[model samples]
Structures are given as C-alpha cells and as structure tokens.
Target: MPFPIIRLDYMQISIEKLSHAYGSVEVLNDINLTFEPGEIAVIIGPSGCGKSTLLRLMGGLEEPSKGAAYIAGQAPEGSLNPLTYIFQDFALLPWRTVAGNISLVLEDHKLSKQQSKAIIDDVLARTNLSEFHDALPHQLSGGMKQRVAIARALAVSPAFLLMDEPLSALDSQTRELLMDDLVALWSREAFSACYVTHNLAEAVRLGHKVIVLSRRPGKVREVVEISIPLNERRERAAELEEVQQQLWHMMREEALAADRELADV
Candidate 1:
C-alpha cells in the first residue's frame, strides 16, 4: 500500500500591482496581496472603494488594465477554475430547487451521476441545507438562500473562494449566525477565501488578515492580522471592538469625503 503525501504550505494566490479602470475612471490602483492555502483574508472599505472589482479581477471574471493576478503561481488562465465566488444577492435561480441550483455547475462536467450526487449531498450537509434541498429560492429565508449559494460554490470544490459581502443582506442576528457557520465551514474545508465587506465587525470576526482600501481609485491603506482563532473569537470580541473602533475612525473620514464628492457630482 502507498501512502499519500500532503504539502500544506502552498501559495494559493498572488496579486501584484493589479490595477483596473473603466474608461477614464480607475477603480483599483496597484493592488498587491497574497493568500496562502487555508488562509482567510478579508478586504474592507467604504462603498465604491473597488473591493468587489478587486475580487472580480482575482477570480478572472474581469481583466485588469495593468499588472497581474495570479492563482497558484501562474497568471490567470481562462481554462483554470481555481476560484469560485459567492455573491451578495445569493444569485440563486428563483425557478430552481436548492439541489437543482447546486447541481447546475456540475451538470456541465463529465462526472458520473453518483459522483455528482455524492458531492452535492456532502456540500448540502456541510452548509446545513440537506433538509432544504427541495426548497426553491423564493421559498427560503435570506440566510437559507445564501447557504444554498454557498453550497453551490463549494460543490465545485475550488481552491479559492471570493465572497462579495455575502452576509450583508441579512439582519444582525441572522448575519451573526451565518458568520459562525461560514467560519466553521472554512475551518473544515481549508480553502483560501478573500471576503469583501464594508462591515468592520465582520472583517474582524472572519479574517486571518484584514486589508483596508482607500476611497475610489482604491489603494491598500492598512492590513491588520487577527490573531484569535474562531473558537476563541467571542472571548476577545471586546479587545477586537477597540481595533474596530480605530478602523471606523479611519474609514469615517474617507466615507464622509466620498459622500461629499458624490454630492458634488
């Protein structure tokens, strides 16, 4: 019998000097970052700071007008599906059942029916949606609908997950509950995630490192490492609250400036 060998310390992603623009407007400016296997990184900034655009560039959904976006040491390739995204809107098909939506991506792949079913079942269980597989998107609660979207993403088993404010739509209580579920899943699954959010508390709670972006033509302002483990999170929430307060102070000025600029235009 042969034993399988595992290499744990892999460079899952690297983005170097990545910049993007639409016509005359620059959204991202010289963004440089990296992600290691099994790490979770959160990007935080005010609205229109290009956090979502950064994720799109990272996932190869959009091209950067300059610089580079790399996944697993290579430049973003059209055929390579290393990244999966979970959208804020849930993006579930209203007409499709949970299982049907989840299996939608897999249907294109040439997999045996049993293999696909097994993967779907496993992800459904992981996301705690096994009981709701028959439910349609319209029939699910906000959190449940997001869970279905997450399950759909996980079903592909990609090496990287790009999340764009995945929990922002839910109420505070529901968001907190789903955040715990997301952390649990991350710990178990070990995929690198880049989560974008404007929520300061969420950035502190879920990130291994949180990178703050400046206002439009977004540049990296700061990157803070969160040392607490998921299980020890609540105990340190007060300490984290202080850090969150500092972050808010920094973001508040920029936010107000952004508002004023928008009002002028």
Candidate 2:
C-alpha cells in the first residue's frame, strides 16, 4: 500500500574510466562517456566490444570492474520508477496482453487502478499501440511488438533509457520506419538514452552525439558531435549521410586494424 515516490525528470549519466573484465580477458577498458539530458548518445563498435556491458553498467545492473558509472538525480532501486532497459528482442511476456505487459512495470509501484490504467493508456497512445492493447505478443508483427515494448518502458517514466540494438531484430524497412518513430518520440519526450549498435546509419540518424569504440576490449576512439537540427534532419538528408560516412571511415580504419591484429594471432 505504498504511493508512487518519484518524479519524472531527465537524468544525467556519466561513465568515467570504466572497465570490465571477465576473468583475465577484458571486454571494455578505460571507457569514458557522458550522456546529457534531452540527448541520445549512440554507441557503435565491433562485436565483443562490450557495448551491452557498457549499457548494463550505465543502468546500474552490474558493478563496474573498474572506475564507475554515475547517475544524477538517483533514487532507491525499489522506487516507483528506476532506469528502464529496452532490448533488441521485444521482451514482452507472451502470456500477457499488450495492456497486461505494460502493467507489469506498475506492479511494484503503489497506484490506484485508475491511475495505472491512465498511465498505460497514455503510453499506448504515445507509442501508437492504442489499438493493440488487446493484442497478444504472438499475434503482433515485429514492429508492433516493439512498439508495445517501447510503450511498456515509457509507462514507467524512466529517468534514462538504455537500449542495446533494440531495432536490430527488425528487417531493414521496419528498422528504418521505427528509427523515424524513435527520433520523433525522443524529440517530444526528451529522454536521455545510451543506444548501442553496430549500425552507423542508425547511430547518425538518432544520435545527438555518436561514440565510436575501438575493437574488442573497447576504448573510446572518437566522439563525434552531430549538429543537424531536428527540423532539418530529413530535409537535409545529405548532411546526415555525410555524418554517416565520416563515422564509416572511422569504423573502417578500426576494422582494418582489428583484422591485422587477428592475422598476427
């Protein structure tokens, strides 16, 4: 019988000298990054570069093997709302209806039935999943299921949203469509995010700043600021492509180096 205990506000997440290792082998080393409120920082790197591990650290799900992750405006783990994570797979419970899946996050919180319904309804509407409230995961298209997952995350009003290739599972066309939806949603909600992916186009299309990590045992190779205004985002398609190309070149260089190292081994 507890009441909701937190307010929804932007959170500042910063990582400093963060490193993680599994036994003697390392996955991420001296990684440093920061995500400001109202911005998306997309992280791109080769496989095994610990992009997901970095997100886990940022979400406070795992302790850093070195350095630390910091979150401003922190709250207790059991608070009504905490950090939310969206995975590449739409992790909705198959047994639950769309509405039921969204309601799962509200369970730990103390809220009147009316209030919970209101939150769920609003989120469904926001994610364009209002009509699918009665749908089951098995019945939904990949895109629709992802929207339901997004709505569930939004229902909790997380301070920061951590995503790990959340759109990777979708086909190319669906991925592109959802990317547009995400940019629009993020524009309206201003939620801070750390999105990890291997897709540079997705990174440039959605990120305010893109962080490129070197090969395995990731380290920050470069930080690129994308200044394309939202209004001009699509209109100025050339600019976005230019930025993407720049990121591609950087990544290409890193990829060659990784190949050379592998050959030596």
Candidate 3:
C-alpha cells in the first residue's frame, strides 16, 4: 500500500548570500539556507562560528550586511511579530513573578484581561509552570528558570522560535531533564524552531534536522535529518552517544581547522 500523503504548508524561510561584519571582522559569509514550517532545525558548530549570529539575523535582532533574509515570501513589513527568541541566559526580570514575565509581552497587544489571563493559564500548564505562577526567578532552580523563558516565548504564539543554547548553562542532570521537557513541548506545540547549540547530542535528540556550520565567516557544512522518534527510545543515553559520535566525526575536521586558524591568529 502507498503511504499517506502529508501536506505541509511550508512556511519557508530563506537566507540568500547573507554576510555580516563587525567593523573589519567578518562573522558570516555567503550563508544560504531554508527552514520549512513545523520543523525543528538545530545549528551546531564550534564556538564563535557565527551560529548565534545567524540566529540573531533570523530573529531580526541584527541586519545582514549583504544579501537578504526572508520569511514566508517577502521581508517583514514594519514591526514583525512572527518571530520570538529564547536566550541562553534566563533573562527573566527578577522583580516579576513567573506569570508576570510570561504576560509581559501580551500587554502590548492590548489584550483584554480575560484574554491575557487565558493565554497565561494555558501556557503555564503546557510548560508545567502552573504551580509556580507567583514564584520569583530567584526561587526557582536553573532548569525551572529556563522553563520560564520557554513559557514566556511561547506565550507570544509566534510563527518561529529562535533558541540560543537555552540548555547550555544547566548541570548535566538538570540539562537532561529539561531536554525531555523541551522535546515534549515541541511535540505538543509544533512550533517551527531554529535552535543554536554546540551540543551535538542535544542537536540529534531534539532537532528534526541539524545544520552544521563552518568556522569563522560561517557557512553551512552539512544538513542532517534525524530518524529516531523521541518517545520511541526508552533510554536516550546510548542512542544519544552513538549519534553524538557520528556528529563529532562529521565536525572533527572543521573543528580542528578552526582551532588551528584561531591559534595562528
């Protein structure tokens, strides 16, 4: 029997010969890629490979020096609300309660009290932070703080989510736990995400597809599709390890070349 056909609306994002520079130092060069809607694409590379810079360009935090970045069809007009970012540092306002932080962006939308409250409640439940709505940032652990960051980003209901090493700061145990939570959230929310990370294991475990970037003046080296399902694995350690090794092999030469270049500089 033939397999059922799945229709994807394909909210296509494209970058064409994009390049960015800070003064004389160039960060990205001739970078071209596309992201399809409802897909989780992770960017991985050695440190300072412009992985985060590319994400920032996608998020509209920074403009490319050359070429173009497009979402859907045309470039966004005026202020774009289609993209939101989750930072590595849980940039939660210390003074605001968990719910307050999540609701912060909603205020600008002129949402009614009832409408805002509904979204807050729903996202809180989805992120498993319903019980800590009134808690302060300091009261939560590292993993919980990142959860608040994720919840806050989701509260905006964006078309695309940009995450920059959101799990890098936590301890191993906490990172693993949050990784599971992240996979669960992605499965349920189905938001298109472009996550930047140096962790190959995290990339393999969480991404539907992974893109590896080259050294300084970063460009795409490869794009890999992950075949395993998150829920299918009873234990992720062995699977993650195997994929991690494969990813490392793919990146080994680039990483070493990058190191040598940096040392010479």
Candidate 4:
C-alpha cells in the first residue's frame, strides 16, 4: 500500500539568509532553508550550534539580528495559532489538571464553555490523554507531562509546531515510548513540525529530513533526506543505523571541538 498523501496546500516555511547574535557573540550565520507543510524536519548539530535558537527565530519568539523566517502561504483554515511551540520542560501549569491546562490556551479566544470543552476533549483524545484529563501535573510521570504539553499545543490547532527536544527530559525507555506515540500521531494526522535535538538516533527515527549544522555561529552543513516511511522505520532499524552513522561521521569532529570549547569556558 502507498503512504497516504496529506498536505497543507499553501503552507511553506522559508528561512531567508537567517542570522542571529547576542551582543558581541554570534550564534547563527547566513542560514537558508525551507520546510514544507506536513513533514517533520529535524535539526541536529554540535552543542553550541544554535539549533534551539534557530527554532525560536522561526517560531517568532525572537527577532533575528540579520535575516528573517516567514511563511510563504496561508495556514490551514481552522488553525487558531499558525505557529506554536512544544518545549522540553513540559511547561504545564502545576496547579491545573490536564484538561484545565489545555483549556488555558483556548481561554483567550472568547470561546464558550461548551466550545472550550469540545476542543479540550478532542485534543486529549488525540494525545491519548483522555483518561488522565483530570490528573494534575504532579500525579503524572515525565512522559505523561510532556503529553499534556503536546495536547495543550494541539488544542490551538496550530499550523506548525516548533518542538525543542520535547523528549529529552525523559529516561531512555520513556523517550522511546514517547517517540512511538509521536510516530503514531503523525501517521494519523500528518502535522508538520520543526524539531530540534542533539540525538542522531532521534533525528533518524523521527525526521523526514535531517538538517545538520556546524559548530557555533551555526551554518547549514547538510540536509539528509530519509525516504523511508515513518511507520516503517522500526522494522528498518539496520538501514536507519547506516544513515545515523553517516550523520555521526559528519559531526563527530565538530562535536568534540565544541565540547572542548565549552569545557574551557
């Protein structure tokens, strides 16, 4: 069977000669890239290569010092926020239950109580959190907390997601489980995202295209495309390993150099 074709027809993201700096320190330089709708694009690089910084710029959280990232076309019709973010910290309100946390995003839109409940219910079901809808943050584990964050993001019906190592805080087993959950969600919905991570195996496992950057003052070094379908990746672990090795070869030296530089500081 062929993979289903799901596209957000007029939603293409363009990064134009993008650069960012903090006072005297430059972080990214002259970066150019494009991200199509409904595809997961993973960005991997050495420790100080500004992967998260680039994501922040793309999501409009920060202004670029010398360039711009803009969407070329319109977002999906029902999207409340055209771009939203999922951070590694989970960012859930400890005082709120899962459903309440999701409702927080919808509150500012002047929605009726019924309308808000419907949206919250939909997102919770989508993220496999329906059973935990009333659970508070402390009652859940790390992975579950991240799921709530993802659900909150989804409640907005975002056109694109800016994910900054959303799985990094979990233990290895929890991380793997969450990756599987993400794969299943993407397979069913085909939502697009720009994901940032330092883990190559994660890039290989979740990315449709992997963008590599050099050490700090990050520049686009390479963009590796994985033609394999997301649903088939688990069974094709050997093939994915080969691709991971290729990425490792490209970044190992820069990774070591970056590590040493951080140590010196």
The TM-score leader among the candidates is: 4
Candidate 3, position 157, lDDT:
76
Best-first order by TM-score: 4, 1, 2, 3
Which runs in model 3 stand beyond 4 Å of their true positions?
Answer: 1-10, 73-80, 233-240, 260-265
Residues 1-265, model 3: lDDT tens digits: 4432333443457788899987777888899887877788999998778999999998788998998887764322322257889899989999999999988878888778998899899889988899999999999999999999988887777778889999999998998898888888777767778999999878888888889998887888888887777655437668767777878998888888777774321
> lDDT tens digits, residues 140-207, model 2?
98988888988998888877788989999999999988988998897787777889999987888888
lDDT measured at residue 45 in model 2 versus the true structure, 0 to 100 = 85
Output the better candidate (1/3) by TM-score. 1
Clashing pairs in 3: none
Candidate 4: 10-residue stretch with minimal lDDT: 1-10
Alpha carbon lDDT at 1, candidate 2:
38
Writing each residue's lDDT as its tens digit, candidate 4 over 163-229 gives 9999989999999999999999999989989999999989999999999999988999999999999
* TM-scores for every predicted model: 0.91, 0.90, 0.89, 0.95
TM-score between model 2 and native: 0.90
Local distance difference test scores for all models: 0.84, 0.84, 0.83, 0.91
Clash counts per candidate, in order, are 0, 0, 0, 0
